[model samples]
Target chain A: MTKPADTGMTEASAPVILGQNSGPLSRAISRLRGHSFAVANLLMAPTMLWLLLFLALPLGVILVYSFGSRGTYGDVIYGFAFDNYLRAFSPIWLPVILRSFLFAGIATALTLAMGYPLAYFIAIYGGRRKSIYLILVMVPFWTSYLIRTYSWIVILRSQGVVNTILQWANIIDNPLDLLNTPFSVILGLTYGFLPFMTLPLYASLEKLDKSLIEAAWDLGASRIWALLTVTIPLSIPGIIAGTLLVFIPAVGDFVTPDLLGGPDTLMIGNVIQQQFLSARDWAYGSALSFSLMAILLIGIFLYVRKVGTENLA
Target chain B: MNDGTPSTIEQCEDCAIRLEGVTKRFGDFTAVEKMDLGIRRGEFFSLLGPSGCGKTTTLRMIAGFEEPSEGAILLDGVDVARLPPYRRNVNTVFQNYALFPHLNVEKNVAFGLKRKKLPKDEIATRVADALRMVELGDRATYKPDQLSGGMQQRVALARALVNLPSVLLLDEPLGALDLKLRRQMQLELKHIHKNVGITFIYVTHDQEEALTMSDRIAVMNMGTVEQVGSPEELYESPGSRFVASFIGTSNFIDGVVQWTATEGSIVLGDGERVIIELPEDGSRPVTVELSVRPEKIRLRESGEEVQPGQCMLRGTVRDVVYLGMTTQYSLHIPSLDRVFSVLEQNVEIASDQTLWVSGEEAILTWHPSHNRMLPSSGA
Candidate 1:
């Protein structure tokens, strides 16, 4: 141990090597250290630049625009204003936010209910055919998101195949209004994001040791009870991942509400779009976008804290 | 080892599990083929083999994880082939101790009892008993991840044993443990087997572990049972070269019969005549292998008198390895190319030189009965 006075003297003085305070050797060492730091910064430059340009800059822009004034021609004015933010707390936006949440929650629930068994089948029973089935799950996306969403329109419309079949079967006297409803919005969202939910769930379920289930069986758990007690609980992380993937996207989706949901089904994303495009109010739209971003960031922070960073990755 | 009590006799006499022609196939691949075994109640039987040798497959089939494609599995005389694993009367202690990560030690142990729908107090009592048996009663609230590997393994054992199943299937349960912990757990497992008196169907590739704990061992290879016998039977009198080499250590010498009759003898490839016993109606000029344990080979001086019924060979000591307890000497025998022999550390050789290689002639002999003759096809 060094004496306290020696420690103080050492702390006050510059670090020296070979008992030399400053010389060519120290300059060479400093150059080497500078070169290493430069190389490290160069290696990490692309990722840091990407975060700044694509993530941080856009988020800063949105925050700044949230507090700025809306010009007459839908352009942001560089002046302080809190009116748009105050309007966000009005009953109009509150109901819209609650409605969007309701739609996202239902879609998440349905997606989980439907995706779980499919994921379980692929993980446990598909065996050597797992990758093939995974490719099959992704095959729907090969055609285009818009076309897939339109295909739902073709099926769920009043005179579409589903309604025609139901009418011909005499299950209903008249064609059902399957489209232009909250039900249609939920159905479309779940259909579009089902694979996102199923894939993560499959990854978690596949990692489950079959012997653990066997051990449960050896412990004399019934088939249903084993699923409830062991299999489902062990798959909690996957379920959370799937729920987040579906719910986060569904809450902010404007296409599903535009195509499948009618006038009363306008969500917050549609409201933001209307504020900037039709209403020509950039300030309100930017504030609304920033609020959504803030809520999502808090949600993701809680999620990472609950699960782990590696699991989220 | 009998207790001389009628109750003990009755308990040991019962057959806890019996498999009849049980065969499991994963699509085109045959995992376990035509396995027939009867595990006695309260006996520790091990299915020992290399990987993909159907040992784990057999244990899984017995545990009802894999249904045999063509056979019957009887547990306590009840057919469990068509039954799912949950309905079976057996528990499995899996490799890596697949304890429920979400549940604490007590809850994991209590899981089985709750399924049986026993009263809450009875479940608690059995859980406590099992935890005490594994010497982990105080760690009731700890989750599996919170405990050390050995403690987690004990919790797995306790979880399985709490149900009091007729048989416990341990699928390489100690495979993941370190060497010292494995040895300690091996003794604990044996002691638990004695205390519980439940049939144990252990699966492992470690011959030393099988020899130490198993009452009987079924050695499997390529989805077939090579041999099933007690440790001493399998080690001492192996019926085939695979068993002889697999169980312990043996040096094989390829030989053919030059002259054979009631008093059997054969000339080795290098013109050394070794004495051997023949079957009741053995054939002539048969290609066979002569097996001798390293311990049976003896070293003697060149001019030593050759005793009756002893085979001797002249070989130069090429290298010696001092193995603390025993020194292994690699000898270059002209009759057999090269051979290795182990001698006890206490024994002193005739020569003092290391590499000048004096005393090139070493006489090796053993009883003719110890010289097993095996068919040369699988060589």
Candidate 2:
């Protein structure tokens, strides 16, 4: 299919006429094409600069400050110490960190159990209205996350929607305490992160070859057994992806816990926010956030190892 | 079909699979209409038709993928039409060889056995034996993505065969392979069927493959079965014009029922007449339409001598196609207003290497034994 004149002018045979070529700019462009690394670096320059300015610089400052101690006036102490690190890991803060992990884990599990069937139904059985179903799944995300969390408050308050309906129906003698509980916080997290779980799972399930399921059924597998053996195993990539998307953000989610949680439902994110904004203990705040990041990194590495790195990508 | 076929397809108890007035309709569009068929036990029965002719739909109904809109799909005397595919004692080899990508070859083959909760050692030995049957023993740990298309197809076969179902349904299973591989797999499949001895219900649009492998083939058209018989019976005595054109090349000529199969005269549209005859098969053709297979007709020099009672026509050679094994000549007969093709073997190699040239006048002749009447040709 090559043009006749271009056959002899292949890359290996083409003369690199730099001096007589057009102008210096064109010559430089041709030279740049020869070195793909230059083109790649040029393409990546904006993203690299953005990350360096916004992400790396802040993280570097935090790393340096995390080793420093708070002054008497809670300001200007520039000496390295293990005191902040030890305090970040102390018994006083341990409960909040552990609760953060536990809440995130439970919320992630709940979202997975809820999202998988929705994704399956939309992807497989949605048929001609699949797009509408998918849009409905994502309807909650169209509103602001803050507004959505606030709407949960309106619903879960003592005399709000559920309590009003139940009281009118006389299901219970008194209004139930639905707000300011771990359950409320967990429910909020699950609702907010549902689309995050479902979209990836839908992508995986939608691409699944339906004939594989038919083949399984033909091979004597009952419907439930076929789903267990065939459908779930093939959609592992989506499961892993959705879990990562929901679990990582849910762990440090301060808004849900702060809005819907009681005093007993405090998380590490709230503790970090208090140290930075309320107490103005920046050094300890940096220490706590750094510890959180390190723990998350370790947990991700362990999780990826158990699931096999191949499944994640 | 408008022309009446036998209404009573005798209910035989020994049939491995039977469709009784099974009609499948998607909305108003009927995919399969009142398909009554009987497949004998341990026979390689093929549902052959062009795409959208309901061959695959009929196979799916038998496999219980879709329940019949009307009537029963009986598997060995028991109506299993309403049962789900998993409950039916039959398996299907999907056209695309839908092997589970997550499972290796051994695990894929053992999947059906595992679903049955077979013991550990039995599952292991059976999986190995199935792999060996498909000649994929060395590739047990290889994922489906790792194997070539042909090998993956073999794995699919082993996966279905390991279940030992009473009937195996193949929906054009070799359709995805290259021609050479498809030919090889076709022979291997026939060999496997011989050893397994289970009734095989194969659905394919390829008439040649059906003729090669099937013990009996049911030719379907539109939404109904046109005819069903052995390969020889179909090629020799097609029941209708559709089967005649679909199965092989046929030059259909409208004729009058002047006499029985051994003697007849056809009155063409332009006041011309043609003579034909063929050996009778114990009954008179119920219709007057006649046809002859193209290969049964031979082309000779314009003035070649011919035996008595041999039908002859003169036509100009319009196109010559040297198809490696046989040279096909399309002759334009102005009197008949049709282009009749004549196939001749390419066995003679002359020093000049000459062949049939366009614009050459030639005489085509064939014994009337090749002339046959269509049973339902009146329609």
Candidate 3:
């Protein structure tokens, strides 16, 4: 008892080991301690620089081009005007823009319908094979996107696997017109984006406390009602994340439409692609791109307001 | 004929819940086996056991979360063996508090009532009353993640209690709280049980909690019921060595029984004789295992004159632990080849010393009535 106070006094008066605090390097270290976030800012410099170079600079160039007009020799005149914006909103391009949104929304809904049950099965009932099932969801990512989209063509073409099987089974008298349609485009888009929807859904659903479902059942809720009220509501964060990841990219997808869609199935992405590549009107393309960004921004804002971003990751 | 215990297979309509030969098995592992028990209406009954001892499994069967692999579970004389939990007239308070994270306190409490399609204003009033009962009336608009753990537990209780089910199954409800909060909630739960007058079947692994709150406790061990009695009855007259040791600390001494009709003497392993009272049943046996609680043994200075008819053993203090209200001494008995414990109440510590110091010689004595003869093995 008499020795404890002496030990405590020695510990309390311990010397600071700042490694000779008179040097310029020591002083620089001391100054850095006053602003702790400076270290974090230093660590973030590379990623910030990358974003500026790749994302911000390109978006800024498009913003500037949206104010320009096409010259007679297919060169940008660089004149300040809203002519391209006005053309982007005209009835001539309205149908394509609406079709883009409609296809993206349907593909997202289809992927969700397919992915939720698969995610639920893996999270709740996969048992010891859970990691293996999650890896299976990611196997398609190992192949090139063009190869996977081309594989869908073989399955959906008039004389491919599905049509041959149907003809042999007497399900159809002749080979059906199954390819180069809006249905084929939407199918390909849904197939490609399914993992984006499932992985986030799996993350949230797997982290859900299973006892909440039991509590609902104990409080007199049927299985269906419990799914609607408890399971689905608790997984809204994952739903919001997956919807944004799938829908935002699906709205701008050109590969699926270019390969599978008919002439009648022209979406906004095809129009934007034609303006830049074939029509040589980069100004109109830039305007249409900015307008699309504005539409998605307002749409996401309204969605977040309605659904509440408080639980979002 | 004299004891009020209903014989096995006897149906009692007064029992709020009864299990008859209920056995549950997962693959080859039997979780609960051939269990027959009855709980009275409005009684606070506890199933106390260690984790793998099947207390939670029994609660789940009662809550209709799991159907027993065999036999019947009768609630209010109706066998609900095959019904789902949603169709049963019971609710469970889970250990993790299982509150809906997305719903506020009021909406959570109103969930079951709304399922019944009650009027909106009626649900509002009942929800308010339930929240007030748990003392979370002002937190009605707060989501579960915002509330503290104890507050979330109260909301779960309210969510279950607002339904007013005939039976409330609590699966280790206070297992997550700190000690002081658990004690406070234990008392609050007792009062709530009294006011609500609903039969509560609580499951816990804490022995003292069961003794404090339960009217009757069914002590489970390894998927079987070891003993079932009132807490006092269980502590005073445990029927088996498992119950005597599991419910609290007990010192066991085994010896050949030498007895007359009224009293008996045990010639211990080393031929040291000790006196004991015969059980009132008076069925004399050849050998016996006797359990004596720590507090039942009184520690005194060496060479003190122990009263006649009291069992005494000479020992030396090996270890001492000073709890606030009591001091526990580990007494090493030489002739018995064992270490015995004696818990002495410290009402007043003598000025010269604090209870018994280590390495001190002492004699442990207790009345013969304190010697509890365990039933013969395999009986």
lDDT of 3 by residue, A1-313 (tens): 0122345455445544344457787778778886667888889999999999999999999888889988787788887899999998999988888888999999999999999999999999999999999999999999999999998889998889999999999999898876789898899889999999999999999999999998888888999999999999898888888888899998988989988888978888888889888988999999999998899999998987778755421
TM-score of each: 0.83, 0.90, 0.91
**What is candidate 2's lDDT per residue for B6-71, written digit by digit as tens?**
542564559998888999999999999988888889999999999999999898888877888998
Clashing pairs in 3: none
Q: Give the CA lDDT, 0 to 100, for residue B377 in model 3.
A: 71
Candidate 2, residues A1-313, lDDT tens digits: the string is: 0124443455434457644569887878978887888889999999999999999999999988888877778784877898888999999978888889999999999999999999999999999999999999989878999999999999999989999999999998898999999999999999999999999999999999999999888888889999988899889888988998999998998999999999989999899899888888889999999999999999988986777654422
Clashing pairs in 2: none
| Candidate 3 chain A lowest-lDDT run of ten | A1-10
All models: lDDT?
0.81, 0.86, 0.88
**Candidate 1: DockQ?**
0.39
> Which lDDT tens digits does candidate 3 get at residues B348-375?
7866766778899888888888888888
Which CAPRI level is candidate 3?
Answer: acceptable
**Residue A175 local lDDT, model 1:** 88
Q: Arrange candidates by DockQ, highest first: which order?
A: 3, 2, 1
Query: In candidate 1 chain A, where is summed lDDT lowest over 10 consecutive residues?
Result: A1-10
Q: Is candidate 1 or candidate 2 better by DockQ?
A: 2
- In model 3, the runs with Cα more than 4 Å from the true position are A1-43, A71-77, A309-313, B1-13, B268-272
In model 3, the Cα lDDT at residue A38 comes to 86
**Candidate 1, residue A215: how far the Cα is off, in Å:** 2.6
